[model samples]
Target: KMSFGTGHHATTFQMLRHQGQLDHQGKRVLDVGSGTGILAIMAHLLGASKVEAFDIDDWCVENGNENFDLNGLTTRMGLGTIRDVQPQGEFDIVLANINKNILLDEMALYADLVKKDGFLLLSGFYTQDIEDLTDHAKPLGLTLIAQQSKDNWAALILQKKA
Candidate 1:
């Protein structure tokens, strides 16, 4: 299979595990820092109606494109950070498995792109980072719903309040 994620990293594995619990059918998804486009590609395979992805690195964008073809999926791929992208619309699900600083800095943008009650899944931080991250996100109308951690790395599922 086309490998955007080798399922090795703790953050990616936790993110994927949580993603399995959500209903992706007909949902719209945003995979920020899409890396190899693994999350985006998985979103498509899980039946998301719209899967959009972007990364700041040229290599990631290139490799992501190749991975899409390998999976026989067509994803809207681009090169940019989440901060630089314009709002398309609120999404049903947003995935950000990037590091703590970026997650903290871009939390508001991520929250804004989520529809009311939509899910925002985040990772690529340590367990110690949760409080700081959630604290920042809460005031922006996000409620920490669930969290998982593996090997000092952590993931969280937040929902936009209605």
Candidate 2:
């Protein structure tokens, strides 16, 4: 409905592929740019306690809600912006599969949303963008813990430092 992520793109695929490495059990999860709600649904299935997701696209919001219904799982889906999300009190795992510019602009917000040592999974950028992203993220309390790439797309697993 929105843009990207029907689980067919390289960024989405790599995120799902590397998902198992992190512990999602009983964690609160947040999905930004939550396309078809794939990652949100997956997080819930992985045992995330509360899964919340939002997208700026009305179609994505509608489609995400439908997907949640289809999966028999309930996720808080709506239209939102990064600024609307008060991540500080809201999540333990934050997933953002957006383009390079948005990723850079909101990395600090994502880092703030996660609790100490909580995980933030990011993708939707080419491999060359990692250095700039990481450089911006380091001082904001996010540390690169893992990364995976395929066909020029890169996915990163970062943890908020305690």
- Per-prediction RMSD in angstroms? 1.8, 1.5
Q: What stretches of model 1 exceed 4 Å from their correct place? A: 1-5
Residues 1-162 of candidate 1: C-alpha lDDT, one tens digit per residue: 333455688999999998998999999999998888888888998999998899888888888888878887776578998767764988999999989999988888998999998999999999999999999988999999999999999999999995
Off by over 4 Å in 2: 1-3, 85-90
Report the Cα lDDT for candidate 1: 0.88
Top candidate on lDDT is 1
Taking the tens digit of each residue's C-alpha lDDT, what string does model 2 give over 1-162? 445678889999988876778788999988999989999988888988888888988888888898889877765687878787554485778999989999999887888788898888999999999999889889988899999999999999988985
**What are the Cα lDDT values of the candidates?**
0.88, 0.86
Q: Each model's TM-score?
A: 0.94, 0.94
Residue-level lDDT for 117 in candidate 1 = 87
